[model samples]
Target: MRGNFITLEGGEGAGKSTQAGLLAAWLREQGTEVVETREPGGTPGADAIRALLLEDDVPLTATAEAHLFAAARADHVENLIRPALAEGKWVICDRFIDSTLAYQGAAGKMGVDTVRAINASAIGDTWPDLTLLLRTDGDTGTRRAIARDGAEIDRFTNREFAFHRAVAEAFDEFAATEPDRFAVIDGRNDIETVAQEIRSIVTERLK
Candidate 1:
């Protein structure tokens, strides 16, 4: 049997990384082998691309950025995510296809369908079985992200409020379109409360 694939998504400071860790831990405690990873990463080739996309100062047009993301995702899904799922290990990813749709596609003024088509070639049919969208207000998420990263903010995080707001709206639209595949979680709650809600959802849905 193939294991489940779960992806967590949200704008900056939405606590995706934190929730991903907690969710992976909980799943492991339930006797499931888990693999926790992040987008534009999880494999060496993808990690190199991640550096260029997030950490480096490279300038890229929206189309170029979208292509780079798709390239990294191709490597990640093929080399790491696919093998782990084949081995029956539950995969918990901090971010995935939805992030690209939200960030570069909608917020960056590129069409979501266009970006989706580009990634379709990269990931094939390996979509996540469930996606947790940790929804948060744009202002609040921006503040939290700034505080969390301090001087190390990434390229996306450095964008203006309008861009972040667009990203949030894009996420909401995606969730609305695919309610079966996405669980919209209010991210303003405390950590434990959010984690428990996620655990409950996973149990009810995946089991």
Candidate 2:
């Protein structure tokens, strides 16, 4: 049987990476082979793309940005994600296609359909089996992200509050549209509380 592919998504500072790590550890305790990774990275090629996308100071058009993200995702899905899933290992990703939809599509004014169509060629049909949408207000999330990153905040995290708000709204819209695939979790609570809620949701939904 193919193992599950789970993706965690949210605005900045939603604790997706932390939750992904904790979830992978919990799944491992249950004797399930797990691989935890993140986007726009996972494989070496993808990681290189990620540095360009996130760290570089170059200005890219929204369309170009979307394509770069798709390129990175293509590398990640083919090299790391698909191979791990083929071996019956649960794959937990910090972000995936929806991030593209939210950031570049909706917030960046590129249109979700356009970005989705672009990603279709990149990922084919390798959608996540479960998506945990961690919810947090824009101000709180921005503050937390700034605190976490200090002076080294990424490009996305350094965007205006209105842009982040748009991203949050886009995520909510996505969860509404794909209720079956998305489990919405409040991210304002403490880390442990959020992790516990995620564990309960995973246990009940994926059992």
Candidate 2 backbone collisions, by pair: none
Residues 1-207, candidate 1: write the lDDT tens digits: 999999999998999999999999999899999999998798999999999998647788889989999999999999999999999999999999999999989999899999999999899999999999999988789889899744468888888999999999999999999999999999999999999999999998996
Give the residue spans of candidate 2 off by over 4 A.
Answer: 149-151
Task: Give candidate 1 misplaced runs (Cα > 4 Å).
Answer: 149-151
Task: Report RMSD for candidate 2.
Answer: 1.0
lDDT of 2 by residue, 120-145 (tens): 97899899999999999877898898
Model 1 alpha-carbon miss at residue 132, Å: 0.2
The candidate 2 region of ten consecutive residues with least summed lDDT is 148-157
